[model samples]
Target: MTHDLPYNGSASLDALLDAAVDAIIISDDEGTIVQFNSAAERLFGYAAADIIGQNLTTLMPPPDRNQHGQYMSRYLNSGQPAIIGIGREVTGLHASGRTVPVHLSVGEIKSGGRERFVGILRDLSEQKKYEAAVITLESQLAHADRLVALGELTAGMAHEINQPLTAIAAFSDAGARLIDNDNDAARTELKNICGRISQQARRAGDVIARLRRLSQKGELSKSSHDLQRLVQSALQLFDHEVRRSNAAIATHFNHRTKLVPVDEIQIQQVLVNLIKNSLDALAESATEPAQVHVHVEEEDEHLYIIVEDNGPGVDPENEPHLFEPFFTTKDHGVGLGLSICRNIAVAHGGNLRYKRSERGGARFTLSLPLTYIG
Candidate 1:
């Protein structure tokens, strides 16, 4: 049921304007303020008496203040509107000499052979503060996820470092046994042994450096990096896990792929999570000749990093919850890996998606925009 309320003309309109929660100001065609309501007075810390005859630009900061008159002229002369009918986020000047974030919408009115513009502005300071807080919390959660993944890879990383150290020890022993020989052949063998030792030492250092990088917690910093090289680095970090699972790892990369802008450590974390999940699935299925295929390709203005494995695919019922926080299939899993991975992808203006592979296994794709501003 509906009932009509009695209209009281200008008196009712005046009451409505003052009752509004947002600031509402009316200005003439010459940009001089004509109406300033109670809400506007409270919002700008100026009484209607003081601001009634002032220019509407008094509420705007520098650039906007200086250009507003021109904008008004252009719109009036050419019928080309910028903010007259549309709403936009802009900076506003406060009476306290501070800048405030606000969303402003303007409408035009012609009355009694005169033109007037009404502006409705809502403060956005609280909204912006909330958005910033959410970003910070997400970053902290991503850092925690990285630390958990590193903990799980501790054994594999130890084995990786030990291989080079063992080789160096054997090379050193060979050099020591040949130290007493004076023949040219013995000298040549010793030189070769010393060279091998140096190579092994450098290899060990590289492993340690990779571990250090993954474990470090810092702000998200973006730079141009080769996607192919980043994928290889992630694979290297999982070398021991691959061997332990006896999984066959294969990579297909487009040589023409160009460098992309991303936070290297964060992207690597996503890659590591996908690869680790595939190997774990393969191990569980005990599939004959297990295989994990990683493919990098560029298409439709986006870059895709796909990881698929020939193992038991995810159950159809659980697919929807795979990326939800605290949702897991493994008995001892915390269920934050995929959640964090997806968050990291979205933060970069990209996304992570999952589907069944042609090889009858789970396939996960991380898609990123090639021209991402971040």
Candidate 2:
């Protein structure tokens, strides 16, 4: 039976090996191709007839191909294995000259006192391409959200600068009238008005500078900053939006401490989104006092900022989908704010989440990495 087994056994084994999803290859003691399965041909973009007798090095790239012969020789002479019976990630050269990433497990087999190596390969090309596509889509969505935020900001910004601009023009006219009247008291009052005019001009300049910086979408510049200061800065960004929606703001920060290490502008962007969401939620509420509360706390190795509103909370069914891109409950919302906020939080090695507030409203919390303090 042992002598008769060789004829049919080989055919059955080859058929079974061909059925596997992963590629299988067997090489002779001299590292020449001995057997190639159907999956191997499909994965390498080559026909079995084309590679059956070729050197195994044909599957490797430049440096790896050069080293493979020496590695095999050393293993054969010393009886010490380098990759046998172990799985490893390596690059493979496809017939199309493309390099493919693969996880390979090789085993050494002995037959008629000669050595052979069988390799099982699992390709990563499809998985890698899917991951790249997801990342690209996310980036495009974030960009769209920023454009929507800019549109809303433009309206608020007009209001923010108009008040100061009007004050400057009125002050300049009064100063000119006082100069013509030639009265000392009126002239002094006019000088004071001129000073106020200059102050307002400077405030408008500051607002413009902030807007310009936010519009550029600069690369993240990280540093240690005061969390309290960050919150105050972000409030300025949303000043007009909150006022137009009639949302009242309350803040709760631990006065004793305020410090963290992070990208200041990015964190401020997160705050602006959270505050805007709060204002939107409050606008939809029928409550007498539309309130938004911002709280910041520092706990071991992390800083937490919570923005809560006394507004209509999210639907229970929509809770899981809140952070998803292009998901929104508002008519004018582009649905990118929360998603961008979460992306910024994750990029900062932190997290963002939404929950029900104690006051029966929506609460968005941003947790950030803190500098390690001894």
Superposing every Cα of model 2 onto the true structure, what RMSD results?
A: 21.5
lDDT of 1: 0.83
Candidate 1 error regions (>4 Å): 1-9, 138-159, 171-374
Q: Which candidate leads in TM-score? A: 2
Q: Where does the lowest 10-residue lDDT sum fall in candidate 1?
A: 1-10
Residues 73-141 of candidate 1 have per-residue lDDT tens digits of: 999999988987788998988889788889999999887777888899898878977765675576568
Candidate 2's TM-score: 0.47
Pairs in clash, predicted candidate 1: none
| Model 2: per-residue Cα lDDT over 34-126, one tens digit each | 777899998998887788778889999988899999989999999888888778888899999988989899998887777878899999887
Q: Could you tell me the lDDT of residue 285 within candidate 1? A: 92
Q: What TM-score goes with each of the models?
A: 0.46, 0.47
User: Distance (Å) between predicted and true CA of 137, model 1?
Assistant: 3.9
What TM-score does prediction 1 earn? 0.46
